[model samples]
Target: MPNPADRNAMLEARRTLKMAQSPHAYVRGNTAKFYEWLAASPVSRRVPTGPAIWICGDCHLGNLGPIANGQGSVEIQIRDLDQAVIGNPAHDLIRLGLSLATAARGSDLPGVVTMRMMEEMIDGYAAAIHDPTSGVPGVESDIVRSVERAALGRRWRHLAKERLDAVEPRIPLGKKFWELSAEEREALTTLFAEKHVGAMILSLQGKPKDREVRLVDAAYWMKGCSSLGLLRYAAIVALKTRKGRWSYALVDLKEATTPIAPAAPGADMPDDDAERVVAAARHLSPYLGSRMMPVRMLDRSLFIRELTPQDLKLEVDQFSHGEAVRAARHLAFVVGTAHARQMDPATRTEWLAILEADRRGTLDTPSWLWESIVSLSGSHEAGYLDHCRRYALAA
Candidate 1:
């Protein structure tokens, strides 16, 4: 067990992380209530846990997306590990369910379809551990397909497209990620063809080609709220391990760890923060590939990954009732499995029961559970906004 000081510091880090990423009007409005709730809740301590391995700490809606495999086979994989940690299972479940609630604010599906979609996500997560290859029922391994499916989702299809006719996502990224500019096009070209990108030719995992391979720039884009002040880059590479087969690989590298935290007090020395984050991500996400370099710059850390087409995030509210229920259940199962992996059989079974009971409608979907998270998220958002306001006023 970690000492009290370390635990307190970690909590402070989380609050600070929130402030650094969200806006002020958002932060001030919701801060104190959240901290108070956390302090009062017995379950809160069970969360914010650590010393395990690889947790998607900030398991929010926007943080999840699509990514392709080495052969460009699209998978419903999770992305955005910037806030990942090796810690408490409760933290992930609470945050994930809370994000689902936030997404409920904008879903297009009635009730059923929304439940199904949510359930599918949870199912997807659980299944991933066993196969890591199962995608949607019939789609081939390709990024475009994942993007299309994610765009349509279950609720949108059931709503007959009526649900999404007017709704637009509140993606934090600028519009350019969905579009492209001339300079950005050129940059993508360069990244893919030179500088950074490559295919592994041999069946070996640790063996290197004994040479630096250049990649072409795949896209010009922007992403992540926490990485507002850091560098993010992506490149494309084609690999042909077999004699006649060829496939595209999209490699991406982004900066994580923000320059500030809302709930946490005191100024941060960015250099150290960047180092810790880069180290953690690299250490935890081994699939980030062996040769992938996590670079440290003056004020930021760069993380590398294969640009998979299957990456996607869904707005929970837009889904149908069924889809939402499904998604919730699906997410619940994944959270349960992750927790089970780190705990004793008894502890694992306990949470699994809680998750399954809720999913099967055996337990009343606790309105209070999601409400608390929203309260927490809202508070952090407020605190963050306050921090930003103070900065803007100073500037």
Candidate 2:
């Protein structure tokens, strides 16, 4: 978290340094720029607008991962809902294409491989749109398999070790977790005292519904690249599991800001930012949505969710040609199913036809998808370089 003394300057410095690290990292952080280019470029006119539904406005590889539900079963889904909205599904496709293309480039894969991966991406998405009940795909790529294995074996102890560096039920004040103000602590305690909040947390533990919950520890959490300056906190809540034992769970409280990702024109959305996020999340990712609660604290709109050990983001730094292609298809299928669930049979068929109509001879993918990725790749490379230079000068 940014120090209250110089919050903006500190946050800007941290965000600039993180984004300057790599092109893929920059793509993940610079979502506003991606939308700006899409809106202003001539390609925007050629893009087909699909049915208005809840979409992950930032559908990058990093945003899609293994998310666990109340029962602790994990599945590949969109893990972040901070930028979700009801909008054209095409925006998600373009954003995901840019993400995979950048990841391929960062891995030093051949340009031909990147082209083939895009085709497979479309194929994977179309397959799910044809059958929404396919659910999460079987693990095919090595990177995905590795992450899946880790997620399956994780428990509360694993989460504690990683997040707190100990098995004790407390958030250690350190780099990732900082000390909070007195007022902030009091507000969080009051927020957790509500019956609804306790029920949500206890839902994961299989404990008595009426069990009393206590605020064990909390801190200002400095997490994520894009949401660096936003109000975020890591809270530990404890409930007595039986007469002699207590159970603990980690809860994440993040402020909901107005999304930079634009919604479809005249789309019906909740006026409250937190409500909009939770509602869109329920449509886009059920496991996560079922665990989320919208709340107001310290006069700010915020959403709280339990952080399970099974919720792990895919950390794909390097990829072989085969892994790149397989990953493209698998992750796209995940996003496709999310979108397909929101469409009727007729709407799915119509959108699928529109997607296929732009393909030319010998090319399996849509021409506009290919063109958008090519244009955005070049633009982001330039943007990434300029960002590094600016950071260097500032340093």
Candidate 3:
């Protein structure tokens, strides 16, 4: 059992309020509930266990987005690995499908549109698995293209304004960033002093190997939905260049907790939560993975990474029929590419064969994916309404 002291009642209340806002918000915040339902569902036994590769265990649509690599090249991929584990690839597919379907419902799009999106999703996923080297298609969607443009045009000042509330060099401790306890602050200072941590800070800009890195400011970060009660901190570090100039980098340190998503039997992964998240990121999202470091902070397993302005999450509150189809295909391709790269040729072939099978009659999509989405969507909708009712009564 988790330590009761670690649970913050205030944050938990805030999280509940956020989840009650909408069905989509509820879906994003309740990953554990989804997994619990999946375990008990009849479809759980029928879903094929593909190659046991690292999967984004909480793979909702919001978790997939454009992230900048160390070289500053931005690509769409899974951005969160909090619940990542070496598990069945089918879980990712079903989770993503459910997310898209829920978004369609939120947008007031017709049920048929959701069905078509699922088909496009399977088509796109299969394409990537077949040709791992090819890039994801359907960037023509306005949402993705606009985000790409915004990410490309952003710089340090943009990041500073959005995250730090100013172009200043220090982190402000207030609503979004609470004051860190003295011990937590001391731990952060000690963490940045380590050789490997300093190397990671300098590696962000490919700064000279010997550049002096110093922790400028840090604070308790009040962020995220499901991860609200966990230990999270934001640290600002100054990198001194040889030219006697200094540049700042924002580093995010988040506690890694026991994942609710079950790993495959006999899966080989580090026992430490932080290491497990880093390992999965390396396999599933090399762009974000290359920039992350697993470390120990405050006697807890935590992962740290430099935050780039280009790192953005996908936000889709509404969708058109055409947009839904295109987005589904594009996003599925992104996820499939991540899963495909980890498997050998023979494993890929076997997985693809499994996915291609069980297509009903003239339908291009697999039956299991469609059925799983339908069932999960209904389950989540019922859960969301019940949650809202309880929240109302509490109010």
- RMSD for all candidates, in order, please: 11.8, 1.5, 2.3
**How much RMSD separates candidate 3 from the native structure?**
2.3
Between candidates 1 and 3, name the one with more favorable lDDT: 3
Off by over 4 Å in 3: 1-7, 138-140, 361-363
Q: Indicate the residue-level lDDT of 184 in model 2.
A: 94
Q: Candidate 3, residues 1-395: lDDT per residue as tens digits?
A: 12335447667777889989888888888888789878899976778889899999999988988899988999888999999999999999988998889889889999999998988888888888998787846445677767877898889999999999989988886767777778887899898989889998788788976888889999877786655657888999999987999989999999999999989999998999999999999999999999999998777899999999998999997898899888988888989999999988899999988998877654466877887888888888899999999989998
Give me candidate 3's TM-score against the actual structure.
0.96
lDDT of each: 0.43, 0.88, 0.86
Clashing pairs in 3: none
Clashing pairs in model 2? none
List model 1 lDDT by residue over 1-395, tens digit each.
22335434444444455445433223222323443656677545434322244455556555444433333333333345555544544455556655565455445434344334345544443443333223233212223233546533333123222311222311122332333345545554554444333334221222244333444234333433343334454444444433444333445556555421122223232344434454444443333333254554333456555433234554332444544565565544444334344445554444444444435443333333434554665655555567777656754
Better of 2 and 3 by lDDT: 2
lDDT: worst 10-residue window of model 1: 163-172
Per-candidate TM-score against the hidden true structure: 0.53, 0.97, 0.96
Name the best candidate (by lDDT): 2
In model 2, which regions exceed 4 Å deviation?
1-5, 136-139, 361-363
